[model samples]
Target chain A: MAKNQSEVSGIFTAGSKSKPSAAKPKNPFTHPLLLGSIFPLLLVVVWEVLSRLEVFPAYQLPAPSVILGTIAGMAEDGTLWGHVFITSYRVLMGFLLGTAAAVVLGSLVGFYKHAEALFDPLIQAFRSIPSLAWVPLFILWMGIGEPSKIAMIAVGVFFPVYLNIVSGIGGVDRKLIEVGKMYGLNMFQLVRRIILPASLPSFLVGLRSGLGLGWMFVVAAELMGASQGLGYLLVVGQNTLAPETIIASIVLFAVIGKLSDWILKKLETRTLHWQDRAAKS
Target chain B: MSLQLERVGRTFAGKPAVQDVSFRAEPGEIIGLLGTSGCGKSTLLRAISGLDNAYDGVIEINGKKVNGIQKTTGFMFQEPRLLPWLNVLDNVTFGLEGNREEKQKKAGRYLESVGLAGNEILYPKQLSGGMAQRVAIARALATSPEILLLDEPFSALDAFTKMQLQDLLLEVWRSYRSTMVLVTHDVDEAAYLCDRIIVLRGQPGTVEREIAITESRPRERGSSELAAYKAEILASLDLTTETA
Candidate 1:
């Protein structure tokens, strides 16, 4: 089917259609994304302006200019890309593998009644234990190599996805099943047509949760003897009191996590266009 | 082409929902099951449709015991229950087991048949209550079922919408001529739709009255014919009468 788009014709075109934008004074300064930076920018401005005006020692709080120069130097040495790429690759691999495993198992258990009963207790048992708790054990099992870190990341992200898909499938309306059976659908047809489609909304939510968990786990995963990731750089920078790199890495992760979620949300909207239409109006 | 329900009964949680119910429907005829709320008319219909297993009965379609949900059967639930993730067309053809393109073909024909030609792309929640119910009906007919079961499928609708659907349903019945069983609390609905009406009443629900609708087809509300059938069903709920 074509991607979901708003239909030109509908039942009520005028009903609660517009978004609620505040009718406040159009202050360019109060935009929230910029507002977060405003105070920090003001502090830096005061510090720099005062220092240039011979107010306090410039050594204590290096000007934003000094930080920018350090960032440029790191960028030129290619350390920034290497660290960022390593973290990104690990996150991507862990997220993809976890998602694939979760989707297959979750949907299977959810769709098949016997499977749901058989696996639900086991999954519940596994879920009760936190992924972080596995970090020490995984390190011992696989050493401080990529396997240990990825294992931690995989464990961290699996449950949200698995539970979501299972519940999503389970949550599919009984009426839909009746409809299928009434039409003479066999077992396979029921799952392919009725169960999976109905469960998609819950499944999508699970995937989004998995993405967030992956981002969280990757940061923790890099804490053990990783030499090249953003997390490793942050730790090294902290020991040397290079606060700028620490701040940069944290900011980078925030941006990347936010960006990753944004991409998933976009995918969700595009793929589940029918649900979006159902929700609006 | 007929259906027979012989000594059919159901119990849930040790409570008798329906018991000792027997009936038959001829080919191309509509049979109505009418009762008060909690009288187990729906339970009986579910047993006949093979949806409920906590029952004892021999349900035969064309003289063959229906072991389970028959391939020739279609059911419209009280709720539309269309998949929220699928469009009207997808919902209508959801039960069609085939390649995607073939299902679409059959779905389009059924949608057009149900007076939903242009609204194929809409979702269930996007449709009006009447429209969603119409999608349910379309989904039912897309299977081209030989027997159709309906359980208060239009009761949620406003009066006008309900009447409109009744007429739409009559038109489809005339065209397809499938044997149908409808369970409804509305006595008028049973009178208007069915060639035979069975009324259930009691703690352990049983058929207390069964009236054959000898009136002509294309029945009207407030007509003496329909009024008599309505009164007959209502009178069955007196609880003093013996089982039919």
Candidate 2:
């Protein structure tokens, strides 16, 4: 028995030694941030070279420097900040409204069987219609103002959050619910303590996707509207044959989209820290 | 607290899972519901815990009929079932009703008793399997329940870890003296820890036999006296041809 015990302890020590060696230190040059920039930088270099050679007419494919110059010009007049602020405010209001409605409705449907029976089919059918298809109808009813634009963005954000919230609540582990019951938690306590926390990771996934779609819908709404937003800027640029303005607007959209996504990603890391550790180990 | 079950029965879609089961447990007694797989021992444990309300007949805890989950019982499942988002201290204090300071103190005491004194801040995912289960044990004990219903709690553990936990369980039971009903398929485990073993068998499962341990702990492990009890249980389970 002593010999057997010693052999078992030896095996355990050997196992621990092997695990550390398996996780070799990553190379510094191959870091993710550095690797991610390579392709975009290469593309910019190629675009600069092509524009210098006058490959395409400057009116159609303006050089990167010309787009930068347009940005600088807009900044001087303070129009760039105005357009950015208005567009951001619209997106923010729409996203918040959509998220609030989705969470409330989703919780009702997810928790109660009768609510699911009443609302599921209608919502699922309505969600199938493309969000952009609502733009014309919204403009017709609410007019070519901020309301229509915000409504369009809200519609864009709603479906993904609703679908994800419903599925997340539905997919909570039954065993965890049983554990709650075993501990003598009341219905309210069960929802607050167990179901909500369990569904959060999935809900965050939906929020990230909804944020992405919000940007897309904002651009589409602006494409058909009056004035004073990035989408209107794009249309005005096209009418005046100013490709630099169009490129500048597109770049701004990209930067804002990347920034909002980065914020959400940080929140996910903080809230789902447990999931990250579980995955690693 | 004492527990009494009178003609308890559970069914699923008109098929009986457990039928006409009746037993009585005196206060602070450690009883093992021993059986093979598919013998409805776990189903019986669930009924006793009041997690399943669609059952026939009466389950009484301390002379009160249990209709829903009772406040006097704590249940430990096969898996540790710790809420993954909570740290060890928070998980141990879960479902406990008290002022924040009182709850934290109680949780701290239980964690210390489970030999997890310095690991209160670790999340569930960061702990090894045995350590996680120990934290779960602390959580169950923190409630100071009159009865602890454990359904195959150690079955998922490795042999060495299982033995260590068994010792820990015995120690905890000695200190708390809570009524315990453990469901397990392992004969040696039942023989070693239980004051009495209730053997369950067949479909629409019913009690087959009952044996009293009679020996006192700390009983010697692998001794001939304990071996005799194990042999009797094995024969009852039909794993051997030897006559008891």
Candidate 3:
């Protein structure tokens, strides 16, 4: 609520306080907190009213205050940030590792026939298996350490990026490549100048899909035995019957995922401004 | 150096595409390889640019056998074929080899010269057909090759755009002093641009006749000199002189 009001205050505070701009009017539904969290707030209000009215036992469904208190308790102990930071770190690492491998392999496999012929089947076979399924094998191989979690996320994130890169490379226009050749560009120049740019729309698609998979896999990777992570908090909360804690962790992941998507979109906007403008029509 | 082809031939799937065709383009001269459809004019252009290696010919560009060599010449296609991913400046300087700042400066200057001033950031999709062709020309000229081969570069353009670009070509040609060979089906277009026109009358595109246009730059459309040259090319094409 404060963040929402602050944003409004900032906008209204921009120069010129004399005659109020006739074109501008206050939006009735501007606050994201009100827009998105309203349903949850209403649900909480109804739950509180219903429980107080003896709709169900008080212990069966705790009030919103109880959930807030639980969150305060988690924060006071310094466990909340630790859990969040660790999970974020794991996701970041896994995503980066997967992205690097995918780009190199994807570009090669996408553009080079011989390399693709040798590498594609193996990648395909491995990608067919689920990320969750790898937990047991990873644990056996790495003994439930950070390596196991990292491996789990990396495995989950790799295929989408790899597949997308290959698709990007394969989808490049042959005509443009010929144009490069006609202009006296050599092989390296052809790929760097023509093939890479031509495949960018596809490469970006790959990055986005792979990024989504990163979050999905991070949750699964955290499901295994671990001390620090939002996913771990949920696991711990579930065992103690603290639904509020579980909800908080779930909210954390949702917020991170949404924020990451927004950031990626910004980056994509800058990278493909022309492409996007062309896309609109 | 002059572009020479001695008994140049290419066969695809056991059919002659360009059969024993031979021609020469001298310095500071425009040569038009005019032909009816399916006469392998574009194929011959590709061969001369060292792009098509599946031909039995000796293509000497600047006295070097550059049939399959490093990019010694620039070839323009019917479509402008500017890289869509790049902006106008980048597309214009695409053939330039240099460091980052140098490439940007050269690219900027060429784009300005092409009258695309201050449109450096605009992509190929943002520009009109005429503007895109200008960038293609900039790219071709950026290479500073000894020979320039244009394959119906203005055929896709509207008549107005074609005429404007034809004059632009003459301006660029005069400045660059590059040996130029342009292929086209338009009798007027060939007459307006070429210093010397090489008409490929028979099939498979062996040179049939040559018509030299001694007309000055920015030649008027209804001038007697241009009309005479056009009449000569049409007669060589076995076309009646009644073409308005």
Docking level for model 2: acceptable
**Could you tell me which residue pairs clash in candidate 2?**
none
- What TM-score does chain A of each model score against the native chain A? 0.77, 0.89, 0.79
Model 1 spans > 4 angstroms off: A1-69, A108-130, A276-281, B97-105, B239-244
Error of 2 at A273 (Å): 0.6
DockQ of 2: 0.42
Cα deviation of A110 in candidate 3 (Å)?
Answer: 2.2
DockQ of 1: 0.36
After the best TM-score superposition of candidate 1, give how far the Cα of residue B109 lies from its true spot, in angstroms: 3.6
What interface-residue Cα RMSD does candidate 3 give after superposition?
Answer: 15.2
Summarize candidate 3's per-residue lDDT along B8-124 as a digit string, tens digits: 888888888777777778887788888787778888887877677989868776576764745657788888888876777778778778797888887776666666666676677
Instruction: Please provide, for model 2 over B71-138, each residue's C-alpha lDDT reduced to its tens digit, 9 standing for 90 to 100.
Output: 88999999999999998899999968989899999999999887777677777766667777888899
Q: Model 2: residues >4 Å from true position, as ranges? A: A1-27, A276-281, B240-244
lDDT of 1 by residue, B1-244 (tens): 6999999988888888888999989999899888778888888878878787668878889998876788778888998888787778888877777798998888888777667777776666567676778888988888788899999998887676687789889988888999999988887788888898888887688888788989887777889878877777777667455443
Classified by CAPRI criteria, candidate 3 counts as incorrect
lDDT at residue B83 of model 1 (Cα atoms) = 79
